[model samples]
Target: MTTSENLTAPRRPRTVDEHRAFVASLLAPMPAVEVPISGALGRVLAADVVSAVALPPFDNSAMDGYAVLAADVAAASPDSPVTLPVPEDIPAGRTDVPTLRPGTAHRIMTGAPMPAGADAVVQVELTDGGVETVVVHGHPAAGQHVRRTGEDVTPGATVLTAGVVLGPPQIGLLAAVGLPTVAVRRRPRVLVLSTGSELVEPGSALAPGQIFESNGPMLAAAVADAGGEPELLRFVPDDVEVFAELLAEKAGGVDLILTSGGVSAGAYEVVKDALAGRGVEFVRVAMQPGGPQGAGRLDGDGPAVVTLPGNPVSSLVSFEVFVRPALRAAMGHPHPMRPVVSAALGEALVSPAEKRQFRRGVLDAADGTVHEVGAPASHLLASLALADCLIVVPEGVSAVDRGVDVEVWLLEA
Candidate 1:
């Protein structure tokens, strides 16, 4: 059925899974770009990274000690220490390492290449820390302190798999494998629009019935955090013609267009009134604080448009539940959803039986306990700011008592 027909008929609430599946089907990984290792931080790898050279390239000493044949020190002890002449000192990065004689020792520092004819190293602490005439006091077994070549990483081995995120450790590994640049998925570009005649920009004096607009800026920042570039448009008045004109102009340059407010079934809903019968489908999703939803492609395959509720909490929650995952998917992120964990609730909570609930919560990871932040109202932005997680109450359940275990999606991760 067409969107308009569905709206007029008896509407069925869309399940969260159903909505997520729809979103996943719409977004695919973005195109890849070659970027220098220094600029690849936080970007998803587009291809497997194979090591061009082995780490450490050569066998080296694992500690500061004397490199010698293990048999030469087999009988040395504190009472009858064996003394050997240290003809050379091997510090790290020394390329010209001299081979040790049968009865002599070479003083070696950590990470220095092991000289030929030496099978083991006696740690400096066990050898009186000597350099010239080393006084060996312990019997170090063969290969006791030797670091074998290619031990950390082998050449031609896949050091980093595709879809891996490049953090500090990943960057270091890439550098170690001699990768100057890597191919990474491109960041999505998004356009955020907020609609409402009663909306006023922050820092401006509010009239008796005007409230400061917030959803645009908040969602824009959230998009950037999800690895997407965002362009936030000013408040669009409650007029269908103006909203359509602005959307047409802004939608051309972005991968996706997101709008806040004017999506619910109200007479003054500019988004619903303007985009109705134009491709976007308005549905009542079976979730609290973000139930009213709309998504559709713009004219002739223009950027996909997603409509979120106007309330500060609802808009932000909708972005987390829907838009963030979509953006991550476009960026080739392996795990698009936020990290989820089950934790016991610190207090009792109630929810409507027919609708799923997502309430602001503070998770104590140290103790695995989650406390409700405030009332589960869509307009409560203050409590949303303090929340580090979203405590989920399934649609099949009605009320959850204190100490009950519920699934929570971590926001800080």
Candidate 2:
């Protein structure tokens, strides 16, 4: 009842670009939904957000000072002062105020709307103050220290465009524009499954030939980080009949079905047995550690399925390479892949003939020269854990000497 019981030879390995383009073509964007502004962080915008009103709404004081006519204070200097009566007081958020008369100054507080006929403001530190009179020893230029209406944002202007990821600054901008609700793309639903009779959960004691299950939790975290809601399917045994039933049950409500293991050229690969000739294609990829990969829709369900390798490092790397980009596209993210840059190889590396290598390394730019961190072994999970980038070595190329410039994919900037 295992995959070995169902007979077939392994298909030819596919190139990385071919698999990537296939996954990209299969993805569709999620629908939009309205959510509270506070809950919209990290979601993509569904519509262009236009400003309802101009920022500031009125001319306001940018400083706490005396609002005066620039013409009256033009000739005033430290040696010869200008004395004017304090006509009225203006504080922030006050709408009842009279226009300033000539030769008189209005005491204004910061953020208070500027009264009519006032062309400039002088700081309190530069004026001699009394109960009703003040002397200005400094002349300020016209329109100085004033925040004009629409200075930050004008009405009918697009404040946020569609497909923009909402972050802290974006939330603040939307709130400042008086928006209490926002339209964002719905989160994609992902179902994660772990396959293998040799696997055991983390808390349970392991027997001989059985290892703890790490792929389920690791891939779930990756899916959530990529903006998908992950549903953890219980580990399926290495029996074709059981796995087929489980797959059918879980595929009902998911946007994607992700599985780890049972796609390689092994004697007892149950996932391959259950999914063989059932609308899914399993093939070895020309990559180390994560050589075995699969993708296609399930037989009866519309959700796409991606089968990754069994090793912990392999599962994570394959998720980063294939599944993450596809999920981002489904969620309407503008940029679906990590940014890549060119860097120098701090050490020499040897690679295989037909496989492009992604070596885990740290990228340092301290002296304006990018350098790699450690060895380029795919099984070195410790190196991958500490790495900020992956140095890409193309196929059929080998022996990159020290100080040679190479391409690096950054995990984060």
Candidate 3:
């Protein structure tokens, strides 16, 4: 079947919001698996994690000091020090000591459990030390220098909620609560392919009409950054039968299929030729660099397929616009896209009519301005690399003067 025969009448060009919502609705969270705590970083929690025990577990000394009753040190001062007999030496990780006597003190190290009948701690630096006797010079109040049980976390409290991505601090908390493993959502398995006859991998000598295939690795990295595991398929030539056979062979275990190139209106578009009538829809989105976009099930086998444009910059931008959000949704991420805000422009800018423009720029938030990073050409990968944000220009607008308020999407925090 021909591409035109498969597609219905061309629909109105979709806005960014409409395309985003459509992609989001096609993705669902993957299954959950229990992973060891040591490798849980960057994985989203599949279930709420509750503290198994109270943090600290018992009252302990926060500093190296002498544990004693507050009344015993009330009358002590710098000039008139009080002497008390040390009945026991308490160190951390030892639980064999007897309770402190009323008139005596116990030498306690930092993190050592506070003995019963001890209501305060006099720091060791303020006392004259000996095996059986010490001189206390400071007056301590009740509960001074003592860490109360459950001060950090109470048992049975929900410490981390579902869909939260685990980081260093969270891993530490889970370890402190005696959890050796965690339940995290499985990473989405993505099958990535690049289709074209005029493309060659990097490090190979290029022919007269061939260029290096940069989109495969670039798209793979993008998928990994969005928390998906990318499986790269061998590059396929401009043949529809071979492309369809390849897709049918690899569609069983993949959660999604992502292809860069060969989905445009060119006559040699193998991906469009093979997938035209097989449940995929190719449309021209109302955006620059990434105008031609396609999405749907791949022969009704895999999860879904998103076909991006052929240009390297266009492929990357399309991933940022479509695939990244879908992968984030499947991983249960709360916020899929980079954060957007308004800022003043440092220079004048022009854009195409009736198409939203995502121009690469550097944000100078300290000076409340966004400066264009480089030339705003859609094929300039260097400009995109240097940019910290994409200054968004709305459709139907042409020129933006310097110092005008504009919308920007921050690439990093």
Off by over 4 Å in 1: 1-8, 365-368
Assess candidate 3 and give its TM-score to the true structure. 0.93
> For model 2, how does the per-residue alpha-carbon lDDT over 1-413 read when each residue is reduced to its tens digit?
56885556555688888888777666678889999999999999999999989997889999898999999999889999899999799989889978999999999999998999998998887798644999999899999998899999999999999999999999999999999999999888999999988888999998999888778988999999888999987578899999988877778878888998888888888878888888888887887658888888887458888898877778888888888888898878988897888877887787886887777778877743355555654455676778787778887786677788888888865
TM of each candidate vs. truth = 0.91, 0.89, 0.93
Model 3 residue 305 distance off true place after TM-score fit, in angstroms: 0.6
Each candidate: RMSD: 2.9, 4.2, 3.1
**What shift in Å separates residue 358 of candidate 3 from its native position after superposition?**
0.7
User: What tens-digit string does per-residue lDDT give for candidate 1 at 335-391?
Assistant: 999999999999999899898899999998788899999899899999999999999
Highest lDDT against the true fold, candidate: 1
Which order, best to worst by TM-score?
Answer: 3, 1, 2
Compose the digit string of candidate 3's lDDT tens values, residues 297-324: 7665557888888887788877887888
C-alpha positional error of residue 61 in candidate 3 after TM-score superposition, expressed in Å: 1.0
What is the lDDT, from 0 to 100, of the residue 21 in candidate 2?
Answer: 76
